[model samples]
Target: MEEMLNNMREEDIKEARLMLDAAVAFRGAMSSAMRREIMKRFCELAGLPFDEPPTIVRRNPFEDENLRNNLQKFISEWCEVDEIATCTCHELYDSFSDWCMCNGLTPPTKNVVGGALRQMKMFVSYKSDATRKWRGVRIKEGEER
Candidate 1:
């Protein structure tokens, strides 16, 4: 089924992202070139287009701006500014999932949420100060550490 395949694809993307985050956390951030290569490899395997490093929101990431804005608004309502200031892909996905359930809407896949988060300038992946977990890391442009 198409839905099942999409679900599998979402899982693949999440696993790929987790592995990428592990590499970065272990190495304290990767060079842009290194990130690109990894992104390219995964994109190729996933049949998704390959974009530059840190701009990996390749292919159709939730092109609905209204949905994205709604998700952001929902997240802001539940989480503190600092808590989501540098959130990770997993956290973003989970929050979106929760939001969908609470609204009685069909949940988007993890991959879709991850992509939309990137498009919304809210995707991050680093060791968190509060949870000490690796998830999305939201750093403002020109302010990344």
Candidate 2:
């Protein structure tokens, strides 16, 4: 590999370096599974042996039984699953945070709450005006934050 690189023109080497740096930057934004897959592909293309890494299981933030139960309770009391109901992501998160505070629980971040809502099988969509919202669900009539 050193001999091959030594034979390359300076411009070629510079371009290769730039490409590698870009790949590293891109990897930082990718999920672990995606990174591993990309690494495996690179190894295959380079004719190198690729050893599979041990799988690292990540615990879901909302996986705690107690937390899940509390979230469900909150949904039951504050939200409705009507077909025509809709709520924006920001509004839902604000209301969820308020509910958590009222119930003496630390509110998770908006992203975490969004993930929990997705896990609960809530359908997400955007309005005609490009506002993101959860479809078929909305806060109860009197539960607006």
Candidate 3:
């Protein structure tokens, strides 16, 4: 083990150390059975003796197709890109909530909407009055503010 460690590239060693550190940090959140199963899989992958079936990680619901479609449709129908346009965070959430209700869909939380907006390349800025708003986008005409 010492000889193998000594022969490993520095970057590989660093990455392995980081992974192990993360595993340790998250250990408290894991069930005992889960921990044992994970360790068993690691041992098997490393060519050590262990007998355990492989476990599958579940997909994140936050990436659901319906949610993505809803968000995209809302943006296309209700929002417009303009260099001078700005909408406050509160106003944005309120408009989104109304859209979701009218469409018979549950609205995502404010934080989730904010994260999605950021991922869509929308920038956040503060107005002169210290109001937080999204830059380069605003609600379209004939839409609720």
Candidate 4:
């Protein structure tokens, strides 16, 4: 379950980054305050500050490093180097949660990539059964074989 949640977190950060890209493209035409607001909102929702976008890893569970020391300054610094305000965090969270629910992911998820990668093992072993020989081996989870 934790693996699932962690995957969602990683996905959220990636999508948020894309939105930040969009924000950069629209910078001159859009209101600076509004753009900044978007960034602020995203950080707050993600439990991050403006500057401290943590390096999320899926080693054991779904926790991030605590190197994110500054909030406002971090945001400002990030804004300077990367396109931070282009995407709002709310949208990323919403999308991530919705995607997880739709995919039947359990709560407190673990390593998502691990779960997915393990599937190859299942596939290799599945065909080993004599009764299943020459039969259509279903690929997707929750699907009939």
Write the residue-wise lDDT of candidate 4 on 22-137 in tens digits. Answer: 78889998886778777886565466647744666655332222211221222232322222222233322233344446546432332332233233232121233332221212
Model 2 deviation from native, Cα RMSD in Å: 7.1
- Which tens-of-lDDT digit does each residue in 1-145 have in candidate 2? 5554466667665654555565689877868777676666555544468999887899888665666677788887888877788889888778778889999999988777777777767566666577778887788777352
**Tens digit of lDDT per residue, candidate 3, span 1-145?**
5454456667655654555566788899877687676666444444457766578788644565676678778877888878888889888788888899999888989877776676556556566587778887788777342
lDDT of 1 by residue, 44-128 (tens): 6567677553555564647887678777766655554454455555665676677678778888777676567566765444454
CA shift of 115, model 1, Å:
0.7
Regions of model 4 farther than 4 Å from truth: 1-8, 50-145
Minimal lDDT window, size 10, model 3:
39-48
Error of 3 at 89 (Å): 1.0
TM-score of 3: 0.51
Q: Compare candidates 1 and 3 on lDDT and give the better one.
A: 3
Which is the leading candidate under TM-score? 2
Instruction: Give Cα-based local distance difference scores for all models.
Output: 0.60, 0.73, 0.72, 0.40
Q: Candidate 1, which segments miss by more than 4 Å at Cα?
A: 1-59, 83-88, 127-145
Ranking by lDDT: 2, 3, 1, 4
RMSD of 4: 24.5
Q: What is the TM-score of each candidate against the true structure?
A: 0.40, 0.54, 0.51, 0.26
